[model samples]
Target: MSTLSDYLNEHLPDGWQKPQLVEALSGTLDRATVYRYLAGSHPRSPAESVLEAFAKVLPGVTVVELRAAANLSAGAEEPWVPPVEANRLSHAQRRALESFIKATVGPIDDGDEPNHRQPSVDLQPAAPALTEQERAEVESYVQRLYASGRKDLADRVASSLVNNPSIEPATRPADA
Candidate 1:
């Protein structure tokens, strides 16, 4: 596999040097940084913005190719598999999602008097309780979370469902 340094040396256009390249990169990176990149000794992965700049400056060399040369990806084509039924969010996730929605969408009010708003006159109906199948799906998601090394999140999710009086506990799979 070609390293980033090798790619740079091979592809840099004629008459271009480290200083010129640095200047072309809009001074975000210094000449020494360019040297380190050419030396293959930069401490961190090149930022995407830097890669984009390089793509603009270097003719015939693309960011994707540069990323591949940097060992960022295998550059293989793969079939996409839709995710296992979308994972059900825990109560905490639900709260976070609701907060995010509210932050982005702001409060919704039907054109009624703001000061006279009534709690009984909600425009949208309340969400229905989860069905048994949905509960099973949530349990599956929790199990997957634990398996994927997110035990803390999984524990919180399970605990939330267990502690909630409104939600019935999910039935566990026999194999679990």
Candidate 2:
């Protein structure tokens, strides 16, 4: 299983940030909605309208293909299969799909295991309750206090948890 970032970074061509793509689509969808799709956390199953929009912006992918990619299974509900045959691709669409496959699929190198594992998209490991950015902001505030020679103030700020009353004392590393 790969993270959503991995799939987006590796599979998508350049210039495919969710916001950029959504704006390009113009009122069709929101970027958060797209992230929900990619993160496989959409409330309802992938909608046709959203799928169609993605098909247009993304190269080498159809609505069906995007749906498949979006609903990659990994300890989540299986992807909802399209119900109506009407929504299915036409002959031309199939031909385009074939061409896309031809371009994207090539021989695996010797000892390479193509199709050895199913592909999946997952969120990055659950981040700390406080994110790196949040921690950086806190650290920056502490640094400002230190820079102003407010050592006591900086120590208080550094030791205090913004949300929690009980704070863990900063510990030195074994190497230090």
Best by TM-score: 1
- Candidate lDDT scores, in order, read 0.54, 0.46
Best-fitting candidate, measured by lDDT?
1
Candidate 1 segments exceeding 4 Å error:
74-176
Expressed as tens digits, the lDDT of each residue in 1-176 for candidate 2 is: 22322343355558566666557667777778766656545533345577667667667655544433433222223444545752665554444334423322222222322122333333112112333444444555555556667678567656543433343433322332
Worst 10 residues of 2 by lDDT: 106-115
* Each candidate's clash count: 0, 0
TM-score for every candidate vs. truth? 0.42, 0.33
Candidate 2 to native Cα RMSD, angstroms? 21.5
Model 1 lDDT per residue over 99-159, tens place: 4223322223222322122222122312223444455556666666677677776666555
